[model samples]
Target: MDKHFEISLQNRKLLYSVLKDTPKDVLCSIPSGFKNNIWWNIGHTVTVQQGLLYGLSGLPYTMNMEVANKFKKGTVPEEVPTDEEIEAMKGLLFSTVEKAQTDYKAGKFKEYSPYETSAKVTLNTIEEAIIFNGFHEGIHLGTVLALLKAVHHPKAV
Candidate 1:
């Protein structure tokens, strides 16, 4: 579990670096053939982790409903996020993982409602959800990388 948390934190840091380096316009742009942008993918990663871990455990998610609604599965970004909103999302990218680590250590997740992910993996416990989140985040990271490439070279696409 500690390794899981460590890896999650490391991935969040890498994501933060990517967001920092990416231009706001590129981050927000929904390139041709893509459903969402870099910002959406980053926020979605956080939202999914919150939903999978806290929501499944029947606990309130750390992020607000608005964020969850905007980035949750099956949703697309409706508008470009303001700088303030982007900063907030950047904060959440790392903070949520840190808080989850602390909460897990404190045994906050007492119950987990088993869920079968879209990939058909069943998460039967909080520990499983925590580990599964890494795989989920990695998938989104790949999407983010591809989005960045497309956004950086729109002419080529």
Candidate 2:
């Protein structure tokens, strides 16, 4: 469990660096042939983690639903989020994981509702969900990197 948590933390550290370093314009730009941008990928990862680990466990999510909904699966960016929202999510990228660790230690997650993801993988436990979330985040991180490449090198798309 600690290894899983550590992997997640490390993944987020790399992700946070991307979020912190990317310019607002580049973060928001949906490059040619890309349906979503870097900001969506980053926010979506957090929302998916909350849904997989907390919401599936029948525990309240650490993220605000209003903000979470903006990044939920199948949703695209409707409008640029406020700078404050981006700042809030930047903090949540770590704080939420910290809270999940605390809750796990406290035995807060007792059960999880099984869910089959779009990729056809079903997660049956919080631990499985956490592991799966890492995979999911990695995919989004790749997408973010690809988007960055496309944004910088227009022909890359």
Candidate 3:
């Protein structure tokens, strides 16, 4: 569980770096042929992690419903987020995971509703959800990298 928690933290650090290094314009840009922008991918990763680990466990999510609704699965970015919202998302990228770690250590998650992800993987326990979230975060990290490349090299897109 410690290993899983460390990996999740590392993933969040990578995301924080992305948010820090990317210009606001590039982060908000939706490149040609892309359904969402860099910001959406990052927010989606946070939202999905919360849904999978906390929501499914019947625990209250770290984020509010408004934020979860905005970035949850099947929702496209409706508008470019304000600078304040971006800052909030950046803060959440680490804070949510830190809270989850503390809650997990406190044995807050007693049961989890089984769920099968769109990728066809089954998550039957909180531990499984935490580990699977690492894989999920990695996928979004790759998407963010591709989006950054496309933003930098529009001709390639």
Measured with C-alpha atoms, the lDDT of residue 55 in candidate 3 is 96
lDDT of each: 0.90, 0.88, 0.89
Off by over 4 Å in 2: 153-157
- What are the C-alpha RMSDs, in order, of all predicted structures? 2.5, 2.4, 2.5
What tens digits encode model 1's per-residue C-alpha lDDT throughout 1-116? 99998999888887898888777888888989998988899999999999999999999999888878999999998888888988898899888999999999999999999999
- Order the candidate numbers by lDDT, best to worst: 1, 3, 2
lDDT of 3 by residue, 1-157 (tens): 8898788888888888888777788888899989998889999999999999899999989998898899999999889788899889989998989899999999999999999999999999999999999999999988888888888834222
Model 3 score (lDDT): 0.89
Q: Pick the lDDT winner.
A: 1
| Deviation in Å, model 1, residue 22 alpha carbon | 1.3
lDDT digits (tens) for residues 20-133 of candidate 2 = 787788889998899999899999999999999999999989989998999999999888878897799889999888888889889999999999999899989998898899
Better candidate by lDDT, 2 or 3:
3
Candidate 3 displacement at residue 137 in angstroms? 0.3
